[model samples]
Target: MAKYGVHQLRGIIGDFSRVTHFPNANLTVVHNQSKRLNQSQDLSHIAVALLVSTLMQERFVWMTAKTNGTTYRSKIVRSMEEAFAYIDDYRKTFDTVEEP
Candidate 1:
């Protein structure tokens, strides 16, 4: 679990030249105070579950994508509780799957 500001997050992503350099699973929370992220930055390859807890009308849009046989999951929510629940459900559903 790691917390980063919008600018810092952008820098981190920009620093990584390859998608494989990212962690297998990541949980990110975007608070109301943070600025809107750059829409061009694609996080599907980074394997992130994003929680947007903001009242702003303009929100970040992300889609699930598979890379290297791994399916990355992402979701946007209005509250922190919903964010945790989403993560918990994802863990229960995917983490328990037996790879064969």
Candidate 2:
């Protein structure tokens, strides 16, 4: 059996979303509350990329931690930022216009 580290917790990273990894599963992070296919896909492009990255890490099958690489680790950073931005935009959207 193989164990994945914190880096393994990240999957696809992109302009829209990120895929978060846990000990036993994956989480797709998206922007906005929309769950429609087109909207979700728009929001989850980054999520998909992160998932693909994770899958690539696993090589679409399985891998031991000893084989993980630093290059792979660097791949997911922007995706997390994008996911945060995606959601942050939504947060701002709900706020009313203020006289500030």
Candidate 3:
């Protein structure tokens, strides 16, 4: 079931919140590491492409861009202060949560 549920493209698309007011919420950070991320190195560079796609979702993502091997950084951040200051015009939504 987990495999059936966690499709990347659909997951990213479905998490958008359209009706809620902007939040002054804190963002969560995501950091990733792998072993084969060097240019023309013995290891493959697959995750690098994935990280690039993920980062393009927003800005100021606070990434520690790698100097070698397959490592990636990310965060699920929310700052109404910064959002309103910068990202207000570019509206976005997040994945849905059921009301309690």
Candidate 4:
């Protein structure tokens, strides 16, 4: 049995969502949020190239952490920041407008 690390979880999520449409699963991380049953699966345009693995145990650590590349990581970070900005704008417009 192959044990997958936390970093690979995003791809796993995307893969799983392609086949199964579970209602309770939070597939947002992979941009596979369940939508209208009659429509086709929605693919989020978000760029998800970086894999930030979750920490499981101290004993099982990667001997040599393999990276796709620093440039890719930077791109991921930039895209994430862009997403945050969009979220902030949406919240300001719809969520916080009525706050006194």
**lDDT agreement with native, every candidate:** 0.35, 0.31, 0.27, 0.27
Q: Which scores higher on lDDT, 1 or 4?
A: 1
Compared with the true structure, what per-residue lDDT tens digits does model 4 show for residues 1-100? 0375332222211112122232323333222322331134222222223222233211111111112211211222124445455434444554355477
Q: What is the lDDT of residue 56 in candidate 3?
A: 40
- Winner on TM-score (1 vs 3): 1
TM-score to native of every candidate shown = 0.35, 0.22, 0.17, 0.24
Model 2, runs deviating above 4 Å: 1-78, 97-100
Question: What C-alpha lDDT, on a 0 to 100 scale, does residue 75 get in candidate 4?
Answer: 22
- Give a tens-digit lDDT track for model 2, residues 38-95: 3423322122222223544443222321122223222322345554554444335423
By TM-score, the better pick of 3 and 4 is 4
Q: Could you tell me how far off, in angstroms, the CA of residue 4 lies in candidate 3 after the best superposition?
A: 2.9
Better of 1 and 4 by TM-score: 1
Stretches off by above 4 angstroms in model 3 are 5-11, 15-17, 26-100
The top-ranked prediction according to TM-score is 1
TM-score computed on alpha carbons, candidate 3: 0.17
Worst 10 residues of 4 by lDDT: 57-66
Model 1 global lDDT (CA atoms, 0 to 1): 0.35
> Could you tell me the lDDT of residue 73 within candidate 1?
55
lDDT of 3 by residue, 18-94 (tens): 32322323221122222222332332211122212233433323232232322332223344343343222222222
What C-alpha lDDT, on a 0 to 100 scale, does residue 80 get in candidate 3?
31
Ten residues in sequence with the least summed lDDT for candidate 1: 10-19
